[model samples]
Target: MTGNTLGLDKILNALFTPYKERVPDVNKITQAMVAKGLINDDSEILNDHIAFRTLGVPHLGIASFEKIFLHYGYKKKSSYVFDKKKLDAFWYEPPYSHYPRIFLSELRVSDLSKQAQNIISKYTSSIITDPVDAIDLNDYEKVGSFFYKPLWKLPSKEDYLLLLKESEYAAWVIYNRYYLNHYTISVHELPGQYSKLENFNTFLESIGITLNTSGGIVKTSKDGLLKQSSSVAKIIKAKFANDEEHMISGSYVEFAERLVLPEFKSIPKKKLTKEHRRDGFESANADKIFESTYLEQTTKNIN
Candidate 1:
């Protein structure tokens, strides 16, 4: 049968002719053109055949060319690696053979006291010792100390298509403000507090998100507010769990309406042990001296 008479040949010819016209140098396009008689003279064509040889097929119309042949009516089948086989290979591979791979980093505490050491030991069971070990302590600290449970294998092409759809849905919900806003508290040292807020506001502004201070309270701008609020809710829930007694009753919902800007500040509590109390006292004195010196410098600048 003529090459055009074959089903795969016909489909490929149709898919590739327009592509060839746009770019004649494309190997697939040139091959399809020669097969379809659009290109003249076999001698004029580059007869290298290396591309076809890599696929264990002899003819230019056979190796990378086979998919188009299959599209036609060539009733031949072979054991080509399919999506399922690739996914299976990924799961069975080393480092992933363990049901869930854990990422770990080195622990760095100036004084690894008994209490601190015990806490570190409990979580270090699943520590990843090799690839992550080379990273500096500061870089590791950014991710925080936590265990991550691998949920599933890396997504397949089909999985990614589904994820795209889900992402679209999520974007829609966020644009529409489908959920309620809740409080989010970020804890850091006192010196970095105001600067952090300013930086965060600048980020929001860059993204066309306005900061609303209506009702004398701070709130997120109208756009993308829902998604931002959901994130805040998660942070609030985590903080409330950490210190239940200190949380204000109905604070989350009220904060949403009042739109009060959240600030990071130190939470003081009585030390549980005498040693802890002494440590706190020493730290407080150092902070006091630092603040006084800072104030004196500021007053001089004003004068």
Candidate 2:
């Protein structure tokens, strides 16, 4: 491992800067936490992970995106497949615990209807080569800029809506294109009143934030060790290639609480660390969380 976090930190900061601007809920939740005294400021809020969405195609998806972090010393920890959602994802463990873990998901293009696959290929086929291979992963500046770079032309509103009918995720990546999907806050690491997801979710609702009510307001793991909730994706003004514009679903914020393992419950709070907590993710929990951007969840956020 390179053990070089200084450069990795810069690369991550590059990804976060634009995302914070794109998603207002980030500041809204952080400010709410401050108001509730759960956190003194953003600095105190431990980031559990950040997620990205991609197209599962030849030149892209996890295959290409994972290279950046893998070069930075992140280790692939687990694989999660959401068959119903037609998504495959893997979460990476950071070289240093202080850094947020990475969850990269890709839509299974071939599994989609022929019409949907055609729409996706129309854009991605032009790539001809893997774009990530063209960038110097060691250059934080180039890598940072690459996230916002346009790999394909903007989809027409008609094409976007068509993909929406098949895969809302496909519609999202068609336009959003590798924008940071969501960054999570480690709820268990907060003060007592907001430590548990149940309490923190209440606090978020109290502050006028809309929670994803897909599978109840809080989605818990079968083992009951991991619980999570997410705010509905921000509705952004999207100007499409069809010369039409409309407010569309964008990135959202996520909250995760990984509970202490049964064997580690005896450890003192001050001395206990992430090592003692329930680790990785739960597919059931993640499946519902992914709906944070779906039409059902986002409709409530509108108006």
Candidate 3:
């Protein structure tokens, strides 16, 4: 049951390699921002967190997915519920201070419409047992494979649309099972201009990356402690069960800048720490951020 069989550092590197490969933009921007910040090679390019979305079916929800991180020294933290979005999620604090936090959310299957439930159940029903139970959680490579591995057959285009209409998050998991949703850069940790989401977003826009404007250029929490935005998902060609290929939104990258609370801002820079910064995700902010991958957002830029 040891999740650190390969050592946490090595395991995380192995896990993220493929994610960077699939979503090239993450690396592209991370590298650019790192240089923009004039950060030296030794310092870390802080990642606020990495997120993953899953269906709430038996064997597929956060319960199963979280074990991978739990094994790597992450402990469950705050719980967030999106009533309108029908999502239940939790954030996990990493064992290592420099490592990114983990945010995992699952669609509340029971909250979905009957038709949507039936369509999702049809594909996931075959997974009668928890697939993670079969894995040697300590085997880093094997555990990494679980994220990209497909768990069920492809859904028909009709079923995909049906699920999308009810739950954009559900439709996404049905086809893109276990793929990384988005990785957020901790803009507050960056040096100079890149340290603010507003400035960082401007730099991103200059490079021709399309930002998700659902809630605004920047989605701010009610308390104004957390500011976040994401690039609209990149469209990738996918062949549905119907044998028709269509452009579907794949994963994208997110940027977050968590500010120090008013009470802590007066503290000297040298004495400031992550604890002084705003922590945990906001449901209202995340609710709009989720639209980054919706079909409407996906096709908005298309000519």
Which of the numbered candidates is closest to the native, going by highest TM-score?
2
Q: Clash pairs of candidate 3?
A: none
Clashing pairs in 1: 7-72, 7-73, 8-72, 218-259
TM-score for each prediction? Answer: 0.16, 0.98, 0.92
Q: Best candidate, lDDT-wise? A: 2
User: Which stretches in model 2 have alpha-carbon errors above 4 Å?
Assistant: none
Worst 10 residues of 3 by lDDT: 34-43
The lDDT of model 2 is 0.91
Who is ahead in lDDT, 1 or 3?
A: 3
| Poorest lDDT segment (10 consecutive residues) of candidate 1 | 85-94
> In model 2, how large is the Cα lDDT of residue 174?
98
Q: What digit string (tens of lDDT, one per residue) describes model 2 on residues 53-135?
A: 99999889999999989989999989999999899999999888899999999999999999999999999999888899998
Q: For each candidate, what is the lDDT?
A: 0.22, 0.91, 0.83
Q: Model 2 — which ten-residue stretch has the worst lDDT?
A: 1-10
Model 3: per-residue Cα lDDT at residue 163: 83
Off by over 4 Å in 3: 34-43
